[model samples]
Target: MNPFYFVFGRSANMVLILIFFFCPVSPSYGYDPLDPKGNITIKWDLLQSNSDTNDVKVSLLNFQLYRHIEQPGWKLGWEWLGKEVIWSIQGAEATEQGNCSRFKGGQLPHCCENKPLIVDLLPGAPYNIQTSNCCKGGVLSSMIQDPTKYAAVFQMNIRAGGAADSDFDMPQNFSLGVPGYTCAKPVQVAPSKYSSDGGRRWTQALGTWNVTCIYSQYQASTSPKCCVSLSAFYNDSIVHCPKCSCSCQGLPGSKCVKFGETPSLLQQVKDPNQEPPSIVRCTQHMCPIRVHWHVKQSYKEYWRVKITVNNLNILKNYSGWNLVALHPNLKSLTQVFSFNYHPLNQYGHINDSGMFWGVEYYNDMLLQEGEVGNVQSEMLLHKDEGIFSFREGWVFPRRILFNGDECVMPPPDDYPRLPKNTARAASFTLSIIFSPLFMLLIIFAC
Candidate 1:
């Protein structure tokens, strides 16, 4: 019954309660700082079934706001709980069919592998085999860009080992087949409803399972894929992208050709079937994509800016490429030439971000390492005098994102600054040396 012990016990209890209330919750493994709520959801719904087989519809929904699945699209794989085989598949097909020699006298199953890898069918698949939202070559657009194209669905006839419902098993070890994506085991979810006859009728699945997958960029690539450069009409010095923004030369996979050696390197014999490696023109910043932002001109009330996205890699062409810029002046955008623009007002009352992409069928496809390897666009924004100023790099973008991945920007101090008095002194000194050289050259020629 000591008073000190009683006070200590109360103090410890209060400390425990504070800790419980103030401790931060751990974020999920797939959490992204840019797209915090981004994740891919895979759903499997049992449609119909016979004694030995069940028809199930598998769907992939991209819930990410800006991230998307692009070229060489998504590949889905899963381990079968039972001796389940794909008797038939629609909207998609198995990459390979393993040996089914044990089955003697009937039609062969579509795939007999214990772990089957499935891929979406390409465009122009036969009508009989196509399902709704099934074939897009696995390309799923981001929800913010195009909501209608963000989901993919495929149905398959699963041949089970037993006849009863309990004997039927769920799939395990689901894989998205794309690196950096980790999928969790399937979990039972409420049945997904379907609409028929134009929303006049509705049907619910008998059973449904869902698998959630998150992406970590570090797991997907060793380095960033893009970088940003800055230039302004007022400053003579162009601030280039940071050195080794994506990667450095002499690294194992960083193979690049010298500026003049690109043609010879391209002519060299290479295996056609093998995937092409990243062969970019030698530069300090070894990034595949370089987005250049230039403050072109200033008018009485409107300022002009030019954005040019260059594809440095010799083999990769970006299809449906998009760029996002976060700048306060974007809200006052008056004109955008040669590219489509969409405002990304992520936070309410904040309209500082805008997405830009090439106009379709014109410059939509940013080609690789040639005359047409880049896409350029111009923007005119009405300046807000209260906050608009060319000093202290205020005209430059706050952030630039290429293809949803944030590009490494030059340091704030490295940004192109307005011409100072010292710049004119250096120019005069250069003129003095070049003037003597010009006279000497004329005398020698005469």
Candidate 2:
């Protein structure tokens, strides 16, 4: 090398090293508290299945858990919010498959993403943030496969209490996240279903789709927005990924990530057998259209939904609101009923994708806060698929307000009973039982 060039290169290397030492990495943390629109919370619960002293399986309830990885090694970055704007991690790190490396090398050290999960965790949150509400990730293939290894890796450090030994009472916050070896990238649902023929017809291939965990927030519509056609403009109405922008994971290596994921979720509804329809609850801040579902009949085929406006300030006059109901288990929607007060105004029809959305008919249709109104719809079920297969028999889309606000609904709980012929599955139930003594390491089991 030329003397001058060699000296410059060495100096550059030194500067980089110095930068690494003096500067620390920065990862995103929480959403911006000052966003003008409004703030929403994500909810979830932990579900565990116990098998034996050596085996325990974990899953999630309503809320979702996601993982993001920091770029390995030090890199040059600028200071933002008093911390260097570079990816970094503490504690132990799970290596992920296809997390920015080649064919043979970066085989998932264990757990995390291909792209940003969902438009963004929060509407305005940045990429590379510390996603709390997260626990272990990466497919525990070895651990899940071998009881011996499972005991070794997970229980080795955990000291189960015995009658003679000290008991360990550790308070832990149980959470959920995809395992890495599985590299199951996060899934984001389309905000609202789309129809090209002016809500008259819809094709699954034409409308909604899925995306990875760290997907970018829809710039035009924050809460799953939809457009009728390419020419139609989108309002800041729903958080959605436009048809043109939807992406698939496993793209780096050019692998195919299939779409049309039918996620089974529980439903929140009441019984149909009662004389008067049973009342369901709206557990969250589903403002403009705070809804409580009811079962009008016991046939397991038909149900009623009562829609309301909880906050007056948040929802004033929702004149042209189109109520949409999504249930992954629904096979077909035969009819949609009108609200009790304005009977004619609340009728809608089902589209091709099994999404039922009805336009409010009343010209000046409005739902005032503290006022409860309802729209009912009829549905047919695939007896085997809807009742016995999924958790709660429903998986509705995240609601959106007429004014384009995203409404967070509570997890499904109050659901209609399974059709008389079928019963809930005990498939997940296992036989082996473990002593309560081993429960001491519940925290470490994560």
TM-score of each: 0.84, 0.25
Q: Taking the tens digit of each residue's C-alpha lDDT, what string does model 2 give over 179-224? A: 1111122223443333668989863321111211211223322332
Superposing all C-alpha atoms, what RMSD in Å does each candidate have to the true structure? 11.0, 32.4
**lDDT score, residue 290, model 1?**
93
For 351-406, candidate 1 gives per-residue lDDT tens digits of: 88888877768987899987889999899999997998899988999999887777
Please give the lDDT score at residue 122 for candidate 1. 90
Q: What is the lDDT of residue 216 in candidate 1?
A: 74
TM-score of 1: 0.84
lDDT for residue 130 in candidate 1, whole number 0-100: 98
Clashes found in each candidate (C-alpha, N, C closer than 3 A): 0, 38
Please list the C-alpha lDDT of all candidates, in the order they appear.
0.86, 0.27
Q: How big is the positional error of residue 238 in model 1, measured in Å on the Cα after superposition?
A: 0.3
In model 2, which runs have C-alpha deviations exceeding 4 angstroms? 1-288, 300-311, 339-364, 370-405, 412-446
